[model samples]
Target chain A: MDVAIIKYNAGNIRSVDHALKRLGVSAEITDDPDRIKAAERVIFPGVGEAVSTMAYLRERELDKLIAGLTQPVLGICLGQQLMCQWSEEGDTSCIGIFDQPVKQFPAHELKVPHMGWNSLDRLSGELFPESLLGSYVYFVHSYYVPECEDSAAVCNYIVPFSAAMQKGNFYATQFHPEKSGGPGQEILSNFLKL
Target chain B: MLAKRIIPCLDIRNGMTVKGINFENVVDVGDPVELGAKYAQEGADELVYLDITATHEGRKLFADLVGRIAEHLNIPFTVGGGINHVSDAGILLSAGADKVSINSSAVRDPDLLDRIAGGFGNQFVVVAIDAQFKDEKWTVFVNGGRIPTDKELFSWAHEAQERGAGEILFTSMNHDGTKDGYACEALKTLSEKLSIPVIASGGAGKEDHFVEVFQEGKADAALAASIFHYNEIPIPELKSYLKQNHINIR
Candidate 1:
């Protein structure tokens, strides 16, 4: 199976590729639109600023290429945030795959980034199996998309938010499945089988 | 609910895992990547690798080891030691480390935190502080806790948070390697004062110590070296013990 991991200005893309390798899938990390479009599975993984990454995507027209992908596409961490309509980070506009807005976690008594392991609540969609309903996944982000109609899973910290969201062939996760340990590997395997 | 993280810290010297006795005596254990992979399978929430190598070649070897560890381990890990510049952090994170921790260098030039955090998001930077209690105060230490500075514990931690630190890893020189417990009172104060997460290190002996650090100390994460490296307290047993004690563990 041909799997292409879309490359951009974000960091830690190698970790995702390494995760797939552990599952016996060697994916090509590329920024070329043709390879991304021709692959059976495409993964958009990132860890960086929203505005600068969005600018890099637009500079190479990868934004439109990613939004129009008809095949099964999985976005991880910042990739998931960029899939939303807009983001509060630097007041940037993102690819409108999911009709949701991303906002920064309000400063309160709780920590801002919401880092570490958290259970995935209300699991739905193909990316998350029924067995993974209450499974723990790794998360490290200051901005989050609130739980909405398209939410595949919800995780509560400061408030209930979408741990994973899906619409059409586009699937996204706010957590890093590549770094969530065994359950994370299961999630990446599910995406491969999709 | 966010689960309390149990981190197994590995000290890397010349690409080999070693257990530091109060940052002085070093005992070679085994390969770091293999030990890390085993810890991950044993339910360790995360891993922290501190590079203690001094030579240039040793540093390069550590970076190579980091890449190998990333290839094998599935869980998130942080790398620290001798990180003086933002480019040093970039090298580690680009090599597949989830986070880069800054210690004495951050204290030397406080703005290093801001530059690294600016270059690679706030979540990428972790400020590690080592301090020892004396004269009714906890004074910060550098150069592997051999040199003491004028920076106080609480004030420096707050300043690090304000300067874009995502988390703070505090190691008590007094409690480290004692096998008694963590600095719970100080940890509680640090946790309450900062909005970012606090990782407690230095003193972890038994399962009860883990419980105390999380519940009483209010730390977001707990890190231990000798107990885990020497197999005195297995990761699985400790986690189950914490769970039985009514602590939220991962």
Candidate 2:
């Protein structure tokens, strides 16, 4: 299967590509719309500031291109946040694909960025196979998508927030499956099979 | 309910799992991938791999080891040591690390923390603080506890939080490997002071130590090396004990 990872000016795309390679699947990393659209599956993986990242995607017109893809498009970390309606990081507007707003963690005694391995409270979705239900996945995020119509999985830190979402062909996760171990790889592998 | 965490720390030298006290008397434990898998099955909440010799020839080996562990393990894992830049963080995360722990690098350039947190999101970035009791204050140490800084533990922790650090893995160098217990006072103070979760490392001798760290120190998690490596404490039983003591663990 041809797996295309959307490459913008972000830090972690190579790793995601490497992960796919380890899974014995060849993946192409690109920002080219035609290449992404042509692929059997697409992954938008990134690690950077939301606003600046969106700026880069917008400048390259990959934003519109990503929104238009018909194949299954998976967004990771910042990519997932950017797929939401808006982000409070820099008061930025996002792709509005998930119809949800990304908001910052409440400034309380709890940490702003809820990092480390946290378990998922499965809501309802076939996005995660039976092997992944109630399993712990790695997560590192400060802003989170509030529980909305599309939430497929939820995790609680200081409060509950959407951990994974699926809206038709556009599926996104706040957690980095590329970083998460077995459960993460399973999720990615499932996405690939889909 | 938030599930508690159990993390096993593996010290690696030349890509082989090793253990020692005060960073000396290194002894090979086992293959990192095997050990990691063992921990996962044993109900360990997470696993940590620290490259003791990450300076030169061992760096590539560490990455390779991470790749191997990532392939087999189903639980979360963390990698630390010799991570100096944002790119380095990217390398480890890509290699299958659930989170990247930074100590010396974060101390040298505070902005490095912000840049990493901004790029990777704060959740992937862990600021590990190695502190020692000195002059009636807990002082931050760098370079694997070889260099001491004037930064106070509390202040530096606050700065790390503000800079977007997702969690604070605090290690009391003085209490490390002492089997006495965690630095409860230090942990309690920091845990009460910061909103971010505080992981207490060093000085866990027995299962009771884990309970004490949670009940008294109020640590979000407890990390141990020798006890777990030497089979002194099995994680499943330890967690069972904690649960019996009315401490939350998973």
Best by DockQ: 1
Give the whole-model CA lDDT for all candidates, comma-separated: 0.93, 0.83
* Model 1 per-residue lDDT tens digits across residues A1-194: 89999998898899999999999999999999999999999999989989899999999999999999999999999999999999999999999999999999998898888999999989899888789988999999999999999999999989899999999999999999999998999999998998
Candidate 2 lDDT, A1-194, residue by residue in tens: 99898888876566677668768898988877788889999999877788888899999998888888899989998888999989998999998888889999987766556756777776566567655667777676778998778987888877788889999998888887875667777888888878
Candidate 2 lDDT by residue in tens digits, B1-250 = 4555778999899989998876778788779889888888888878888988846779999998988887776666789998888888888877767678999889889999998887767767779999999779999999989999978899999999999887899999889979999999989999999988889999999988888888889888888888989999988899889889997555
Candidate 1 local lDDT, B39-140, one digit each (tens): 999999999999999999999999999999999999999999999998999999889999999999999999999899989888988999999999999999
Give me the TM-scores for chain A across all models, comma-separated. 0.99, 0.96
- In candidate 2, the residue pairs with backbone N, CA or C atoms under 3 Å apart (3 or more residues apart, or in different chains) clash, namely A47-B119, A48-B119, A109-B195, A110-B195, A111-B195, A111-B196, A140-B123
Q: Tell me each candidate's TM-score.
A: 0.98, 0.87
